[model samples]
Target: MKHKRLFSEIKADLTKVEKELDKLLAVDDPILSKTCVYLLQAGGKRMRPGFTLLSGRFFNYDFKKILPVAMAIELIHMATLVHDDVVDASLTRRGRPTLAAGWGNTVSVATGDFLFAKALEMIGKIDDPGVAKILADVSVEMCQGEIQQIWSAFDVKQNFKQYYYRIRRKTALLIGLSCRLGAMVSDGSLRHMWLLETYGHCLGIAFQIIDDILDIIADPDEMGKPVGGDIRQGIMTLPMIYALQSSGHRERLGQLLALKNKKEAQVQEVIHMIKNSDGIERSRTVVDKYINKALKHLEELPKIPAKKALRELAVFVGERSY
Candidate 1:
C-alpha cells in the first residue's frame, strides 16, 4: 500500500491531534505563536503520534486519554528538530526556512525551549508518574546523544557500537516511548506494550538509517535541503561508516571527510565516492534487518487492522526516500 493510504485508518485521530497542537501552541505573544504555528504547519508524517494511536487500538482505544500523550510526543519531536537546526546550522526544512534561519538562533533557541516546556506541561496532565519519568529520561538521553554526536564529529574511526548507541538515544528511544505511552495510557497488557515498544524501537533505528542514506543520495529538491548535510557537518552516519570501513576509496574518502573546512566540491566528491561503494547497499541491508525485527514483534500482537498497519509502516520506514 502507498504511504498515505497506510495511515487512512488513523486519519481522523491525526486530524484531531493537529487541531489540539494548534490550540496548545497558541500564546499571547504574536511572534512566538506565529513561529510555533509555522513549525506545525511545515508538515511532518506525524509518525510518532500515529504509532501512539495505532498502539492504543490494540486495547481500549480511548482517544480522550491518548490524544494528550500523542500531542506531547509530537511536540517533543518538533522541539528537537528546532534545536537540531540551530546546532547543525541548517537553513531549511521541508523546503522552507527553518526557525533558526527565519527568526535567528536566539529566537529559535527560545522557541525550542518554549516547545519543550509546553510538551512537559501537556504530558503532565496525564496522571502517571511512570509515564512522566520515562519521557523525562528519554529527553535527557536525547540531549546527551546530541552532545556525543558533537564530540564525535569528524572522527572517522568511530565504530558501529558507538553509532548504535548514539542513534538509540537520538532517534529510537522517543519512538519506542510513543508506543509504550500509547499502550500504557489505554491500559493495554504489559505484553502488548513491550511488543509495541520493541517494534517501534527497531523501526526507529531503520528510519534513522534511511534518513542518513537520503542525506547522501536524495534529490536536493525532494530532501528540502542540500544532500551530504551529515558529511558536511562531519557527522559520520551508517553509510559513511560502512564506506570508510570497506570501500576501496576509503583513503580519499577519509581525507576529504577529515578536512576542517571542506569546499562544496570536496563534500560532493565524498558523497560520490560513498555512493559508488558498498556502503549504501550495506546500509540498506541493515535497514532490512531492523524492519524484519520490527515485523517479528508485530507478529505476537493481537491480529487486528492496526497490526497490519504497523507492518506496512515498518516497511515504509525501510523504503522511504525522504
Candidate 2:
C-alpha cells in the first residue's frame, strides 16, 4: 500500500496489459478457455508487467512498443506458475485453488503449455530476433533451476551458494529480462538497459527471499497455503538452511526434518525451533543486502519520476507485510 502511487503512475498502461492478456489467452475450446480464465481471474500483483512499464519510462516511454513485451513477460510468469502448481501439487495460490488442484494435472499442464506458446507469439509480434533468443535462454535457465530444486529436495546438507543460484535462475532471470525487454523495445541506451537489468535481478532475488520467509511466518489465510508448507514438501528454503547450519539446534532440526515425512508433527516442531534460532534474522539480513544492491543501481538513474518509484518499489517488495 505504501507504494500505491508507484503503480498509479502507470495505471493506464497496466490496464492495457490486462486487456491484452485477456485477448491473448482467449481460445476456441470452452474447457480450455474456462480453465485458463479461471486461473487468470484469480489475479496476481501483476508485478512483472508493472516493472516492465516503469522501466520503459526511462526513455521515450512508448506505450505502443512496450505493451507487447510487457504482456509477454507477464504471460511467461503466469505459465511458470501454472506449471509450478502441477509440480508442487499445490492446493492453493493467492487464496484460491490452484489449476492442478481444481482441474486435473493433464488440463493444468496443457494450460501451462498454451500460455508458453502464446507468450512466444506475442514476442514474435515485436519481430526482434534478439529478444526472442533472450527469452529462450530464460526458459532454459528456469528449467534448470526447477531441476535443481527437484534434485535437492529434502537434502539439508547443501550450502547457501546453491540456494542463491537456484533462486537466481528460477526467479531473478525473468524479472531481469522484464526490465531489459522494456528498455530494448523503446531503444533505450545500452547503459540504461544494463542498469535496469541489475536493478531487476537484485530486486527479484530479494523478492523471492522474502517470499520463502513468508512461507514460514505468514498466516495461511493471507498466504493462500499453510505455513511451513515448503518443509512439508521437503524444500529447504533459506531460513531452514540458516537454522540447519546453526550450532545450537542443528542436529535437533535435522532429526526433526528427517522425520517430517513420517512424523508430520515434526513440521511444526521444526518451524518452532527455526523461529527460536537465528535463521529468520539472518535471512532477513540477506534480504536487505539484495535490496540495497538493487537500490545501488537505482541511485545511478537520472532524476526521473520512475526512478523514485522504482527505488520505492524495490524497498516495498523487500519489506512487504505479506
Candidate 3:
C-alpha cells in the first residue's frame, strides 16, 4: 500500500492538527512569521501525529484531547528539523531551501527554539504532569543524542551499541512517546500502552535505518537532499558502519571518511564503495528484523482497523525508499 493511504483512517484528525499547527506557529514578527510558515509549508509525512491519532483510536478515540498532543508532537518534530539543518549545515530539505539556508544559523536556531517553546506551551494544556514529564525527558535525551553524534563524527571506531544508543534517543524515544501519549490520554490499559510504545520503538529503529540506506541510494530529487549527505557531514550511519566492520575496502573507506574536507569525487567514491559492499544489504536485513518485531507487538493487541493500519505502517517503514 502507498504510505499516504496507510493514514486514511486518521486523515481528518491529521487535517485538524495541521490547521492547529498553522495557528499555533503564527507570530507578529514578519521574518519569524515567514520562516514559520515556510517550515510548515515544507511538509513532512506527519508520522508522529499519525502514530498518536492511530494509537488513540484503539481506546476512547477522543479527538479533543488527542489533537493537542498530536499537534505538539509534530511541532517538536519540526523544531528538531530546523535545528538539525543548522547543526548539519544542510541547505535543503524535502526539495526546498531550509530555514538555515534562507535566514542563516542564528534565525534558524531561534526559530527552532521558538517552535520548541510553542510545543511546550501546547503540551501544558493537557493537564497531565506525566505527559509533560515524558515529553520533557525525551526532549532532553534527543539533545544528548545530537551531542553524541557530534562527538563521534568521522570516528569509524564507534560500535553497534553506541549507534543503537544514539538512535534510540535521537529517533526512537519520541516515536515511542507518541504512541504512549496517545494511549495514555485515551484511557488505554497499561498493557495496550506498552504494546503500542514497543511497536513504535521498533518501527522507529527500522525507519531510521531505511533513511540511512536512502541517504546513499535514493535519487537526490526524490530524497530532497544531496546523496551521501550524511557521509559528507562526517556522520556515520549503519551502512557505513557495516562496511567499515566487514567490507574489504574498509581501509580506503576509513581514510576517505577521516578527511575533514572531502571533495565531491571522494564522497561519490565512498558512496560507490558502500553500495558495492554488504553494508546496504545488511542494513536492510536489520530493518526487516525491527519491522518484524514491530508487527509482533501489534499481534497481541485487539483486532481493529487501527491495529491493521499500524501493521501496514510497519511494512511501509521497512520498504520506504524516500
> What is the TM-score of each predicted model, taking all chains together?
0.97, 0.96, 0.98
Looking at model 2, residue 162 earns an lDDT score of 91
lDDT against the true structure, per candidate, is 0.90, 0.85, 0.90
Tell me how many residue pairs clash in candidate 2.
0
- Which candidate model has the greater lDDT, 2 or 3? 3
Candidates sorted on TM-score, descending: 3, 1, 2
**lDDT measured at residue 156 in model 1 versus the true structure, 0 to 100:** 87
Prediction 2 global C-alpha lDDT: 0.85
What is the per-residue lDDT of model 2 for residues 1-322, given as tens digits with 9 covering 90 to 100? 4555678878888888898888777889988899878977988888888988999988888898888788788888898999988887788888888989898899999999999998888888876888889988898899889889888888878788999989999899999889888888878889989999999999899999898888888888878777887887777889989999883878988876655364557877888888888888898998899999999987777888888888889878987634
Clashing pairs in 3: none
Quote model 3's TM-score: 0.98
Please list all clashing residue pairs in model 1, or write none if there are none.
none
Better of 2 and 3 by TM-score: 3
Off by over 4 Å in 1: none
Candidate 3 local lDDT, 33-102, one digit each (tens): 9999998887788999999999999999999999889888888888998998999899989899889999
